[model samples]
Target: MPKLNLSQSPAVRAKWEENLKLDSQEKVTSSQQQLPNSAALTPQCIEKRWQVIAERTNKAALLDTDSEKQQNLYSSNIEHFIGTVKLPVGLAGPLLVNGAHAKGEYLVPLATTEAALVASYSRGAKLITEAGGVTALVINEGVTRTPVFEFANVTKAGEFVAWAVTEYEQFKQLAHSTTRYGKLKDININVEGNRVYLVFEYLTGDASGQNMVTFATNTIYQYIIQSCPVDIHSCYLDGNLSGDKKPNSHTMRSVRGKKVVADITIPAALIEKRLHTQVAKMVEFGQMTTTGSLLSGGIGVNAHYANALAALYIACGQDPACVAESSIGITRMEQNAQGDLYASVTLPNLMVGTVGGGTHLPSQKACLDILGLYGSGNARALAEVTAGLCLAGELSIVGAFCAGHFSRAHQRLARR
Candidate 1:
């Protein structure tokens, strides 16, 4: 590939070229001394410069309404707003969900470039809807932020944990006092050597509560510092115990956002007719996959949960990075007494929100609105819908694999 210099005006280009003449090491040292446009890198100024670069590349006209919308939305959330890269958005659904909060048919907006993904999920949705929709429930809801403290000895740490346990109500009050919408649910203590990790879990209303839990946990930390009997050797806000953005057994066993499960019962005849596979074959494949996952020491055993979660995250304006842990879960199918296949997906750490984060952006809001998941009182509804989508995706992939047409579908849709 050739280098494309889409720098600003002639004067700026001249400066950039002059700097480029130096050796790599010297250029790095010199650039550190003086940044490019040090005083004029405001959000608005940055966007203006990006416009110039776009023009130089003969793509200035591509910077249309989307550029303006994204730039404006990013101003409040980011320090520097350069530009927006467009991801092709596709629609999949009329995914029917008989969920506690989410009910009725929903059109799932998916943002992806993968050719066959939307089709596969839509096929699953069709089967689910035909079978009278997926049943979904939000079993639990909490977002955790852990803080670790190191004491001089294990004894001191134990003592501190005991103290924390005794005064749990006081700490809960302190944590709750920090935020209007965040409520402290519980605090779990883990002691490793002389260090103690306090896993503070909170119910963050209608929002992914990373910031909310952080703010509340800090208040509890302050209370401990002032009132605790033990002397702390070292302390930090996060100790990786919260399982944030990382897949681990800790998060899979506990709750992150809403521990939601979605399931459906498919008659054996329908399974064979629609999926092109018998109920016994589907159950066998599920067991095989589960065993394979277990042999690989996987945290969650499932087929392509991340596929559905990532598409939904991008379309709904969520923290895309959370898909790391959020996608970890189990997909199960069994042959019932009535010769039907009972399929279910349980996502333990499905961290999502109907408000805050990127949900307010124009395109993201539009996608959320497609599922009627915009604004408050719909976080659980969103979780249920997400779980249902995951189940649908699982069925499509597993069915395709079992039917020996996985590659055929991909070659037909993706190769084009």
Candidate 2:
């Protein structure tokens, strides 16, 4: 990519500007699914459709490129279940979020004013037309696996890791019920600061398996100590201090050492340096009251809309705790023809459960009830909301920065 100055020609800038347009004209283009963005909900529309759900459960529509195809969009191996919820307020969106587990297009609840933020970002997307798109680099991403306890302090964290990896089958054999958890995949054990954190990955057969993972780990604790040289007396008594929860209730929420980074790539051709600068801002905001630290700015930005979408996540039964890590990631967009960059946003820590926490919360449950996306294994759907939000952040920031009217929209939105 040569650094050619784009200031000389109006034609070139216009071409790039057009490329920067972040138009989701699909709703505008297609005839069948078209409904007013603000149309009142109908009883006929009330009947839930699609295999996966929008993050904002109130808007339960889905768009599967595969939905147009024959083979099941909802996998045969996977099952659909709902715990159901009710919403006290209206949830609106075009909240965009993407996740490893989520594959297609769907709407999500906009937890904040940023819910429809793509519109604002798209405005930026259009201005950078001379530039083309934005870019993204995953400076960081990874999920948290909490502490493991042992009665006696066993020094060899390596030994446990090696054994877990090498003796995988043996550990698999020790389990009394693969029945409860078919999803258990890898066991990662890390020793940091007089404590070891065990992160066990599983292909949980069905549902958001937080409790299932805890139960399985607890069941396996005895086997680890009895077979390995690690001591077990002190760890046995303090339970939550053991698994992915907390070290000691005293320490509260803090993360140290042993992490996994997941990332997505976005083109830099469209949004240019604005892409990098904006994401850095996101990390600066996005507060986590539980941790007393704002979500790092790298991954995405703080959005009123994203907040609203998260509300649906909390209300609908997702792990409200995970939004900290899951919501941050890179937004990349770039231009194919010129040096002008492109953009897309990445969100990493949007952990939502279709089954636990406040999913049963009345307004929350009804909201999920509207989407028919409640209960177990709906994490994928919720993740999409977070991803969509990051994208909205990118579009909003870039479009606003480029067009010179960015502050106007924000001023109006914030005034009331």
Kindly list the per-residue Cα lDDT of model 2 for residues 1-416, writing each as its tens digit.
23335775888776655554434344445544433333223322323322123444643223323232322322322223222322334343433223344433334443333433434544432333323222222222222223365433344555555565666566555543644544455556656554665655554432445555556655566666677665444454123432232222211232211111222333343333444334333332222321332343222333332443345555465555544444343344444354333344444333454545556544456666655556666545444444443455445554455445467766776674
Model 2 ranges with Cα > 4 A deviation: 1-91, 94-107, 112-170, 173-182, 191-197, 225-230, 236-309, 338-341, 360-362, 369-372, 375-378, 404-407
After the best TM-score superposition of candidate 2, give how far the Cα of residue 294 lies from its true spot, in angstroms. 14
Q: Top lDDT: which candidate number?
A: 1
Model 1: colliding residue pairs: none
Per-residue lDDT tens digits of candidate 1, residues 146-244? 889999999998888888899889988888788888899887888999999998889999998888888888888888888888898889888988889
Instruction: Please tell me which predicted candidate would have the highest TM-score against the true structure.
Output: 1
Tell me model 1's lDDT, rounded to 2 decimals. 0.86
What TM-score quantifies how close candidate 2 is to the native fold? Answer: 0.49
RMSD of each: 7.5, 23.2
lDDT for 396 in candidate 1 is: 90
